[model samples]
Target: MDILQILILAIVQGAAELLPVSSSAHVIVAEKLMGLDPTAPAMTLLLVMLHTGTMFAVIAYFWRNWVETYFKSPHERRTNLIGIVTATVATGIVGLTLQYLIKHIVANGDPHFEIEQLFGNSKLMAAALAAGGVLIILSSRIKERSGVELSLKSSTLIGAVQGLCLPFRGFSRSGATISTGLVLGVSRRRAEEFSFALAVVLTPAVVAKELYRLVKHQGIAPGASFPSLIHMAAPGLLGMVFSFIAGLAALRWLSSWLESGKWYLFGGYCLVASLIVLWVN
Candidate 1:
């Protein structure tokens, strides 16, 4: 990719990764529009790196709360830790189950495949986006009616939503999962925190999966022969740094705005994005 493409991808990764929007959807659209090969191993590596960058941003932004809640417990620290672990486990089960089911079941009979096949279908993506959007809107509406507060059950529900998001590229995992928490009575701040925490936990697995694919395909380590990997990494790192700085700003802004319970606005965005994707593709 060119420097301009790198910058654009970085910006999209940085912003959309944190926002309720599906960064993957936007990136895929951009790839197709730019005539870039979505199946290229090097490009996939760059995407993983971009995800890692955002993961770092989440950690940097939430370090304080993480320490206070996970480390500074005067009592019940063990319980809190267990709750976090249970939620993580639940998320993993759902995510991996769907992944395997799709790889084995959906693609079972196919003799040929393309990397773009990872996206499944645009129509499916559109449906997922719309579904997630409605859930978010309803969650926000519920918060307005009865006030929002998150608990263990709500977190589990969010984890369940994350699992469903694993296979569907455009579902917006953060949006659907966060909205699940909100609708189930999770506070906006906690919802956001849990969302990022889940991201951090699951990111390693996602990167590993992609790496395994690279190894299987090329019969060698990735980033070895692919000069594009190096090129992609540079801008990915730059974009990640920018995203971290920008995320801190977004977090501050989101805290107050979320309290106003305007989550439904994202539904409109998803609806519009769906139409745009359909129109283009």
Candidate 2:
């Protein structure tokens, strides 16, 4: 890809990554228009770095809040840790099951089937975006109760919702998870925090999975190919830096938008965006 293409993907990813907007929808559209293969090893590696960049942005933004809340005391640490663990377990169970079903049942036992191959389907992405939009709109209608807090059950439910977004490219993970938390009566602030925390925990595993897929596709032994793979990642490192800078700016916009009582507008935007994706396709 050219420098312009890399910059476009990086900025789109950084801006959309933490927003209720669907990043995959935007990225896939851009890739298709650019004549880039979404499933290519190079693109997959770029995706890993893009996600890593946003993950760092999330940590940077939330560090103080986390230290004060989740790490303040023994009781807080224990409780928060359990919440994170249970939610992640729930996410794993649901995500793995979906992967198996998609590969085995949906693919009719096709040995070479990979869900990532389906990610660039514009119609499928449009449907996923529409689904996310409706969920966000519905959840936004529910008012957050003042005393409601995160609970184990709610976390599991939220994580399960996140799992539903795993296979589909255009479904917004942040949108769905935070909406689920709101639907469960958690305050919006806590829901956003927990959603981001879950994202931080989940991103590394995603990066690892993408890396493995890249290695597998390349027919390279992981140990021997390490240096070569690192060399190939050099261009993506630039994307990571660009994305990190954009993410910092986008994070502030997201916080302000969330507080502006127009969040449901994002749902409306998603609905319109799905149509635009169709047109672009």
Candidate 3:
């Protein structure tokens, strides 16, 4: 891809990543429009790099708040740590289990089947978008309780919902997790914070997996030339920088809407977006 295309993709990914919208869905659609193969090794690697950029954006935006809120006291730190760890463990288990089940079901007797093959299914994306939209809307209607703390049970529930988002492109991870938290009576701001924290923790593993897939597909064995690896990663590295800037702006926008009780507007947008995707595809 050229720099111009990369820039456009970066902006789309960065903005949508922080919004309660599905960045993957938007990026995949952009790829399709650009006549690029969304499942190609290069494209997948670029997508992960974009995710990394937004991951950093999350850290940059939330670090101070995290320190003030979760790190101010020993008891607060311990509580937050336990919640994050438990949620992460739950996410791993559910995500892996679902991936295995889906692969087996789709593969039947073929061992070569990969879940990436389904990433371009527009119909599936539409369905997932609708589901996420419904969840967000329902959760938005619930009353926000004050002084609500993150509990193990609520965190696990949020993580489980996040796992469901893993294989479905249009199922927004933030939307699902934050909504799950709200449904469990967590406040909006806290829910948003914890959801993004989980994202920062999850992104590195995703990036590594994509990198491995790219290298394996390219027949780059262990001890491959550093120059060749760098050459392959160069375009994505440029995209990452652009994405980081866009991500910060998007996060600001998202935060404003969330704090102003406009969270349900995103749900409405998602529903409309689902129809648009269906129509365009």
Candidate 4:
């Protein structure tokens, strides 16, 4: 990819990743329009780097608040840890189960079938986007309830919803989790905080998975030379920097809209985006 394409992809990834608008969907559409293969190893590597950038953005934006809220007291810290652990475990279980089913059953027991193969399916992406959009819209319309904390039930539900997002490109993880929290009567701010915390916890595993796939596909065995890995990663480093900057801006935008009771606008945009994807494909 050229510098211009990288810039566009970085910007799209950064903006859509945090805005509950499904960054993967937008990035895939952009790649398609640019005549690029979204499933290529190089492209996937860049995409993973972009996600790493956003993951850092999440940590940067939420660190102070996390310290204040979860670290204020020992009891609070323990409670928060329990919630995070529970949610993460649920996410893993559900996500892995879905992945197994997709790979084995949907792919007709093809051992080599990778879930990334579905990433380029525009029709499937449209449906996932539409599902996420509807959930966001419905959650936004619900009356804001007070005094609800991140309990086990709420966290489990949120994580399960997030897991469903894992195999589907256009299913927004942040959107679905936050909406699930809202629908379960959790406060908006609390839901957003928990949602992003889950993201931070989930990102490292995803990044490692992508790196493994990239290295394996490049025919690099375990204990490969460092130079080869660096050469492969070099093209995506600049994209990561660009995406980091854009991701911070997008997070600010998301927070503002969410606080201003304009969250439903993102849902509207997603609904329109789903149609656009369907039309384009």
Q: Please report how far candidate 4 places residue 265 from its true position, in Å.
A: 0.9
Residue-wise C-alpha lDDT for candidate 1, range 79-174, written one tens digit per residue: 655656777778778877876667667788465643247684788777777777777777777743345545567667677778888778778877
Please give, for residues 25-78, the per-residue lDDT of candidate 3 as tens digits: 888888878999876767777888888999999999999989997899999999
Q: Alpha carbon lDDT of residue 61, candidate 2? A: 90
Q: Please, what is the TM-score per model?
A: 0.86, 0.94, 0.95, 0.95
Candidate 4 residues lying further than 4 Å off, grouped into runs, are 219-228
**Candidate 3 Cα deviation (angstroms), residue 157:** 0.8
lDDT of 4 at 77: 95
Q: To one decimal, what is the Cα RMSD in angstroms of model 3 from the true structure?
A: 1.5
Off by over 4 Å in 3: 219-224
Model 2: per-residue Cα lDDT at residue 166: 94
Clash total of candidate 1: 4
| Model 4 lDDT, residue 280, Cα | 80
Question: Model 3 reaches what TM-score against the true structure?
Answer: 0.95
| Candidate 4 lDDT, 161-242, residue by residue in tens | 8899999999999999988988998988888889999999999999999989877887455786899779767768988888
Determine which window of 10 residues in candidate 1 has minimal summed lDDT: 143-152
Q: Rate the local accuracy (lDDT) of all candidates.
A: 0.73, 0.87, 0.88, 0.89
